[model samples]
Target: MERRPAPSRGTAVRATRQGDAVSAALAETDAFTSAQDLHARLRAQGAAVGLTTVYRHLQVLADRGEVDMIRRDDGETVYRRCASDDHHHHLVCRSCGRTVEIAGPEIEAWTAKVANAEGFVDVVHTVEIYGTCTICAARPAT
Candidate 1:
């Protein structure tokens, strides 16, 4: 497969077959997945896309806020298609990798209050909460 140079940050990434394939593969799963994993899945589905291409597409999507990424405890970044374009937080299941998007009005207010108290300007933030879900917690002792 021919390779294209990686798109620069904030560059407008036009749609292509490979990029569409990557996004389609991501939409098939609700779990956040690694680039290698997504590449494998694309191959399994007979999509002619490479791992590097997967990474690049994911990076572009993430830059556009079209995807959500999380760094696990081990430091691997995983990507998932965004459910909402609006600002929100994620509650991730540590055991199953399930994610739920949520808004925190109180947290937003608190962030504003704290930042204002310090006279901070142009504040931006992200919040992610990780824990085992009820199903994962209910399984019999392994």
Candidate 2:
């Protein structure tokens, strides 16, 4: 479990307070969710937050590294809780839009080695492995 980056000062304060509806909403959700979906969930939770607020909160979280903001192939931004330990990656299911977390020090080392071999420094990698999820695999093909 890769440790998530720390929340911003603003978010930190909010997550500590009951009325910090935005932070509370985010905290209650699964690791992977869209900001729009999160806004809907917050509304359903009786939080007085708006889509704009959700977006802003998500930006702050992203800046602080508490979350991962990914761009799907279709150009949608998705968010997920950054796990603990700083040693994880994602296994994304293309069919069902689900994501799984995976971690291995060897993978990280390999990435570093590849980057170094290519004369790349401080390289940031985004690796999305696409496949059908178990649910999708188990279901009868349409």
Candidate 3:
């Protein structure tokens, strides 16, 4: 097994702050965020944290399964804390960078149906839908 690096003093500080910030941030917004974006936004929102600290904290949270880092088609990894204890999917707005949470039993049923029909067993699915959001659509062209 690979060994993990020892946590530095800064890392420890960030870890504590990140936990608090992540909780507060999630409570305040419905949008998904990447480390870079979160760093910028948090700073703008007066968090007084650095970019490196944000990235490190994000990695730690992701490793612990406390947050999900989703890599978009453009290669940016966005993160969102899991809000529910059950399985769910997301609808992402490409234009406004918004995300919607969705959950239903019908999705589970359909996944079982399709997987069995295709002769596959023990399958899992994660669905993400992307489209323009209302805010983006209503905005004037640049």
Candidate 4:
């Protein structure tokens, strides 16, 4: 994994109230939530943040490696607060939108070997597996 530069002290101190609110909201859940949904949640909590501010803060957090963004099958982008500092991947449930964090040493080795074989340097990769969870799969057809 490529290391990102630590945020400057000034940058850390300059975090806005809206950004803090957004971060607090995100930290409350492990689900991949859309910006609209997050805005609604903030409003429910009596926060005065707007949808645009939520999106902007989320973008900054994603860029800073503090959050992860993934696309659903419907093409909507969702954001989640990453729980781990070490490298990992997500196993996402298609029906319920539940996510599980997983680490595979073999997958890491394979990725590095493939990248080296292709003469690629400083390679980074993302892997997300999607399937129905047991509970979802066991449900009867509506």
lDDT of each: 0.86, 0.71, 0.73, 0.84
Give per-residue lDDT, candidate 1, residue 1.
48
Choose the strongest candidate by lDDT. Answer: 1
Go through the candidates in order and give the C-alpha RMSD of each one to the true structure. Answer: 3.4, 5.2, 5.8, 4.9
- Best candidate (score: TM-score): 1
- Screening candidate 4 with a backbone cut-off below 3 angstroms (N, C-alpha, C), the clashing residue pairs are none
Residue-level lDDT of model 2, residues 1-142, one tens digit each, is: 2233344553342342222566666666444678888888878877777787788778777787777778877788988775553757788777766777777667788899999999999787766667888988999978
lDDT per residue as tens, model 1, 10-126? 345567899989988899887888899999989998999988889989998787677888888899999989678888888889888888888988889999999999999899998
My TM-score estimates for the predictions, one after another, are 0.88, 0.74, 0.71, 0.84
Candidates 1 and 2, the one with greater lDDT: 1
lDDT of 3 by residue, 1-142 (tens): 3333324332333326545675466556567787777777788888877887778667766676566667899898888887875788888898766888789678889999999999998797787878888888899999
Report the Cα lDDT for residue 50, model 2: 73
Candidate 2 stretches with Cα past 4 Å from truth are: 1-20, 27-31
Hey, what RMSD does candidate 1 come out at?
3.4
Residue 19 displacement in candidate 3 (angstroms)? 3.8
Predicted structure 3: lDDT = 0.73
Cα deviation at 27, candidate 3, in Å, is 3.8
Q: What is the C-alpha lDDT profile of model 4 across 10-106, one tens digit per residue? A: 2442467788899999988877889999999999999999999999888778877889898887999998898897889998888777888889788
